[model samples]
Target: MQKYTVLLLINFFLLLANYSSAAANDSFTLGVIADCQYAEQANKGTRYYTSCPDKLSTAVEQFNTLPLSGVLHLGDFIDRDFQNFTVLNTISSVLNTPLYHVLGNHEFSIDDSLKMRVPETLHMPARYYSFEINNWLFIALDGNDVSTYGWPKTSKRHKRNIALFNTKYKGHEDWNGAIGAKQLKWLERKLNTAQTQKQPVVLLSHFPIYPENNHNLWNAQEVLTLISQYSTVKAWFNGHNHVGNYAQKDGVHFVTFHAMLDTDSTAFSTIEFSPNQLVINGQGRQPSMVLPIN
Candidate 1:
């Protein structure tokens, strides 16, 4: 009996060690789509060539190749029509990898259809949520971080934008770059826990959180103040102000993909991470570069 018990213990320890080694070497790829507005047709009665997606369908088809660890669309999945349930369901269900979204102002700007309904079938869950995968944490924010502005129909512009933002964002004061008290508090708690565990964290939102984000967070200075306090927070990703723009702030790199609606067409970004470095590259636009760890 003693000899049998000792053999069992040895086997258990070996299996545990093997599991740890396998997990350490595992890596993954992710696909990012920003501003698809799939529900709306291109060249919608308006002459606003400045913003639109002519090649969104083709790009999404490419992502369907699906080997991605997962995929995320930063925001603006559809335009002014939450009732475009068909589009929402099609893409959400069709994507090969699990899909996550960062709510853009357009998402809240629910227009004529279905009247900006909340708790719909398409939405996954609460606005703020995070996930742990392959031992890494990825956080997705409901709204923007800077100034915290939204799609409430306060004015003509807000009225148009509210087609999506009005659901919970209506009656709420608009913001251009402020992380609201609620989100900031939540973020603090999350970041503290991450730091305590010595785990790396990646942040995602529709608007920019860093100076390189183009539009500054309502109080970017304050956001940075909080970030500087934590060492575990690694990269912040966002996709709000569209393409023809890119910036890197402090150690945080702000990446904006080419607008799916524009002539620049569809593009994808790949990030390769190692213990010593994180590499970022874009497919259709912007010259790729490397950031060495300091």
Candidate 2:
């Protein structure tokens, strides 16, 4: 009887030790789905527009089974039509966790009068906003704010964007956009607050800000410079180029997730954030990589 009691105490101690170890290594996972671009329209180029609904369904079903803190759709949730938002929402409803969105340029493809309605359709509180999960701050930026493609031709903002594109960034076209002065100030404030709180940040946008691609944001350099100024900023996740890309600048990881609209296969990812590293568990066409955080 005494031997059995000793064994029981030993087992209890072992279990307690394991629990403490797990608590010490606590990590969180985020479900990432980019560029669903769902529509009833037929395929265009490599984008299988009609396949997105089914693909999103699969992604949601899979994400529901994982231990995700939340799910983030990087943008371009629809291709062109407003009607496609209904389909995208229905498919995304299967997710058991909270879902967040970033506004993509394609979201404004509807009539100029209805351009502001896109955020409402997505149920976002604002065009750009911030949220927190597990001691980390996530900022979602609206890359279409100063773009010529989404605004009415006669609008001042549209004209200004066109002029800026033509004069300074002639190489970039209407599809790319810049972050206006107001948004830039707001972003700076958010970063300052996060730094004051000693919280790490992950930025989300629809337009890529690095790799010097044609699909990059019109003011990529400005955004990159702002982000580089903040040591608390750890990663920038985006989606615009369907091919996908990754880069690291000033200890910040810039990851452009592959578009879910491309190919019949689904493209999504589960990103696990630990104290030392960021682990990406990619599904379908999304490539996996583990990045060390400074």
What lDDT does model 2 reach?
0.89
Specify the poorest-scoring 10-residue window by lDDT in model 2: 19-28
Residue 147, model 2, lDDT: 79
After superposing candidate 1 on the true structure, give the runs of residues whose Cα lies further than 4 Å from its correct spot: 1-24, 39-54, 112-122, 144-177, 212-214, 244-250, 286-294
What C-alpha lDDT do the candidate models reach, one value each?
A: 0.60, 0.89
What tens digits encode model 2's per-residue C-alpha lDDT throughout 1-294? 999999999999999999878755568999998899877776888889888888888889899998789999999999898888988888887788989999998898877777767888898999999999888999999888777786777788788878777887787777878888899999999999999998999999999998788888888999988989999999999998888999998999999999999978889999999877899999999999999989
Colliding residue pairs in candidate 2: none
Instruction: List model 1 lDDT by residue over 42-61, tens digit each.
Output: 56442223243334455557
RMSD of each: 7.4, 3.7
Lowest-scoring 10 consecutive residues by lDDT in candidate 1? 144-153
lDDT of 2 at 49: 88
My TM-score estimates for the predictions, one after another, are: 0.71, 0.90
lDDT, residue 33, candidate 2: 87
